[model samples]
Target chain A: MRHSLTLRIGPATFRIGSAWAQPIDQLARLYADYPDVDGAIADFTVRLQPTSAVRRWVRPSIFITGDHGLADAAPMSLAHGLLAAEMGMNLQMALGWRRHLLLHASSVEKDGRVLVMTGESGSGKSTLAAQLGERGWRLMGDEFALLDLDSGAILPFPRLVSLKNKAIDVIAGEVPAARMGPLLGATAKGDIRHMVPRADAVARMGEGGMPALLLFPRFGSGPAERPVGQGEVFMRLTQASTNYVALGEPGFAALTRFVAQVPARAIDFPSGEAAIAMVDRLWSEIA
Target chain B: MSAALLVMALRDPATTAALDATGWNSLIAMARAERLIGTLAFRLEGLGVPDAVRPILADTRDDAAREARQAIWEADRARAALAPIGLPVILLKGTAYAAAGLPAGRGRFIGDLDILVPRDRIDAAADALVAAGWEWVKEDPYDDAYYRQWMHELPPMIHAERDRMIDVHHTVLPLTARPTPDAAAMMADAVLITDGLYMLCAEDRVCHAAAHLLADGDLQGGLRNLWDIHCLCEESSERQDDFYLCLFEKAAHHQLTAAVWRALRLSHHLFDTEVKAYHVPIEVDYKLRWSDRAFISRLLARNGWGQETRKALVFAFFVRSHWLRMPPLMLARHLLTKWRKGHRPQ
Candidate 1:
């Protein structure tokens, strides 16, 4: 029942498991048009069976099976689609963590250092990261950035900067030849997303870069881009960070040390253009 | 002494039966060990509590007591490192039990340290902990978003290297409740010990505990509230009247009088504590509206209600009390706004 699907994230090729053998072949054929995908990992296997536990909040239209179990059981509803996507993303995060320190951040490379941009999802993190990546900066990751805890270095696990709605047009307009992945039907947030792969991500697979700066970016409807003060940055970053309290003494020490070594900034941009320009300036300074 | 005797006398056959069935001896033994460690904590430093309670410390035979003690020591070491940061490390609940000269393992079993810091300093606190080698327990994007957007506390952070866990609460209430008495005010009212950590005043602690019990509505939290009320009232006997009045004043100040009174009444009835003297000035009909008489009758029947009636009464009172707390006009306005915004009526 186990089947594999190769996903090219950054330069690394991860083979994903499908619970059934047939759909695995289907997915392989689906992506057969792309030649760059290297190899995949058989990490997950899904199944479809009649059980009270799997009963419909909604009945699915497409019943695709994978080596892991079921691929997209509930294909019709936006809620189910989001659930499936989240489940897949979670699987990737779990697998990725074993190989590297998976940070809850969005990242772009400046000079040799990775400028990690972290915020809650919908803080326009992926959009900003994608914009930076488009400006020739190496994209480390648009969702989670893998960091080496011991060395505080970021390892690239770049894939597509998953853009939704207007972001798709923005990215497409910016990079006309960018390949579009499958357009997921719909999501709770909006229509759906498929992203253009970051070229740098494909080139620098498994490569780790030192984490240079941490920035918390917010897009406001103002007229200018401003660098928020250090104290303000510290407060915002702290509020935004996960595991701040759990890290206890050592966690706090690591954060202070990390922040001291790297410049932490809160960038407020009025528009996407302003955001891209500000990041470009930061990239130049760091380089 | 009389209050303790009274608590001892009311111990019903059913109470004893339940306790015995649940291995109360071992639980008490664990509690006693924690109390012993609590005594040790005070002896090492007069962090809080009077010296008189120090002599009456009990003993325990439970192995979990040892594990709990080791955890306490580890936390103490971690607290020591954090003390120099000038932020008050207010040890909460189980840690407070140990620091306040009670048996460390006495009250309830605790898995890890629960500490409170000013919400503003939470980040700084995290940074300090990370430098000491603690790793985050789990990292998820949605979890980060949920904590940042909807929660008052960051996700529960566990030490990567040790068994210790720290729950950093920025606000005592959930974001949904929108409880008043902002973090700054609470921090301003905190009592700083010589060890450099602070403790919420008894008033705030009681209110916080009450809010938590009401929001969670579990048996254990109810039991804990009963224990806290009994302990705080008994231990602070000299200030008992003052404390009760202050508790009422503080609850009213925070617009939580209804929740506090409801929780107090329920805890009193459940534990057979004497609380009839405390009075609410509002008339029952005016307060509860539709079910005023029935609710009042049920409150009176607290002495002999069957388990089902007790449960129903608790739920009824909880709903009624919270409803009473809300301004009827505002509730109507909110409903109107929801309707205007195209929210379908359930």
Candidate 2:
């Protein structure tokens, strides 16, 4: 038995797979009118095989059918969860390709790019993104920002901000009436994700914003936060990008163009609340 | 002829296993072998060989052997071309392997050509190569910025018309570590081959190899380098005094005596290569640790497992030779670059 799942984030579509036979009707009922749900794209395909001396149970073969191409891999019990998470991450990467080109940092738009927060995964990017979104900042992407290579313009891919354990509680408390979803299973990091609804998804789905300010945000336990220099911000953000080297001359030109245009900064906040307030304040100042 | 050669090559279970593991279809293997043969023929000509005997030397019915020869030829041509640009090219692993008289096309396949140039002329050297129709290989924006801003070498370049690749480097490492040795001075003393191209003298070459081995840590690649050092030292032993004196001069010039001492000790222990008398004290343990058998053995097991290990080991010998010919600071700088890139520090 095999099962396939599809998720659409921005313009990208991801197809996933499962090993055992699953009732399509039940799956449809579960995902019916789900906000994150785009549409089903893959037909489930399974291949049976024999066990070999090097292995115990014969791993079933599963295939995902979609626009990218059919991806076939071993269909074990663990494959479903892994595929789902992979699809989510891949969607994020595709949606935010532009930002990925420039800084390779996570970002969210607010008041037409008046505020853009950038940081690596553990640096509280998701928490900050969620808080800003709650305060009326349009969610851009948690993973990658797809930048038009020629123009260096950022295209928006507003999606759910994945919140982990403590952050999930914090968001729920902050927006008590916010629609909360079930706890998704643990990921590689052992933290569970609860898909919270994006506040501006309905209004801003067709809207895109220009990037103005770049920020590198970090959460600290102690008090006393100060602004880092432009040089240091450039150095740190440049190092964080994925294709910084792969883009070659065009990449460099784009980076220089970006840095020159956007004012970069580093912000340190002791708590998520303080961080949200600071971001709001910064947004107000710039707007 | 092709079928017979394939049959003969497949007689070895190792080749069969490699073919299976890599999922190389027969057509792909044949095409790869043909390309390899073509590249080899091109490279041998660059080495000043007449075009007549090149086909004879490069001809291989066996896909793997032909492919290996082709890689060797590309590497040689890449090194040879560096001469026309006024830069001294120290042909590292591939050309060195071929030069050491290994089976013509049966050695390690080179992915890219590694050549060292003086630090001062790095920009000019890169421009020179670029003028010769070598395009800078595209890298991601972050990597592009990092290489331009921090790295010792520009992104690698590939010839537009040929299958040759070259990594043009200035200093061996990044600037953060403050490694010594004036690249400009070394280039001044470089030995000119045909055209305006030059190569580091035997002494500088040996020092470079030593530095590479020490700073690169226990990378599996070091095995090939060690073998190269052993073979090159043996070949140049008759001029041992001259080589040592040149090495001494470089060590003194660059203030890299510690690096030289460490390289010398490791060469002596691992490859049994002798170092001339120099009154510089060095920690033998630290030097030995670079080429320690336990470390090499582990790396070998991890990278060159199965029957292919023998051929890989043979390639490792020649690869080791390139490390000794570099200055210590250059090697340190190279290691730092790799570290900053999030690659395992060699």
lDDT of 1 by residue, A196-268 (tens): 5454565666677887777777766543445556666556555654444433444455555556677766677
| 10 residues in a row with least lDDT, candidate 2 chain A | A42-51
User: Which candidate wins on TM-score?
Assistant: 2
Q: Candidate 1: misplaced stretches above 4 Å? A: A1-58, A61-83, A91-102, A176-178, A228-253, A285-287, B1-346
Model 1 whole-model lDDT (C-alpha atoms): 0.52
Q: Write the per-residue lDDT of candidate 2 for residues B132-206, one digit (tens) a residue.
A: 678887666756776777665688788898756777767654443345556666555655443332455566656
For model 2, what is the alpha-carbon lDDT of residue B139?
A: 68
DockQ of all candidate complexes = 0.01, 0.01
In terms of lDDT, which candidate is strongest? 1
lDDT of 1 at B199: 62
Worst 10 residues of 2 chain B by lDDT: B301-310
TM-score of 1: 0.40
Candidate 1, what DockQ? Answer: 0.01
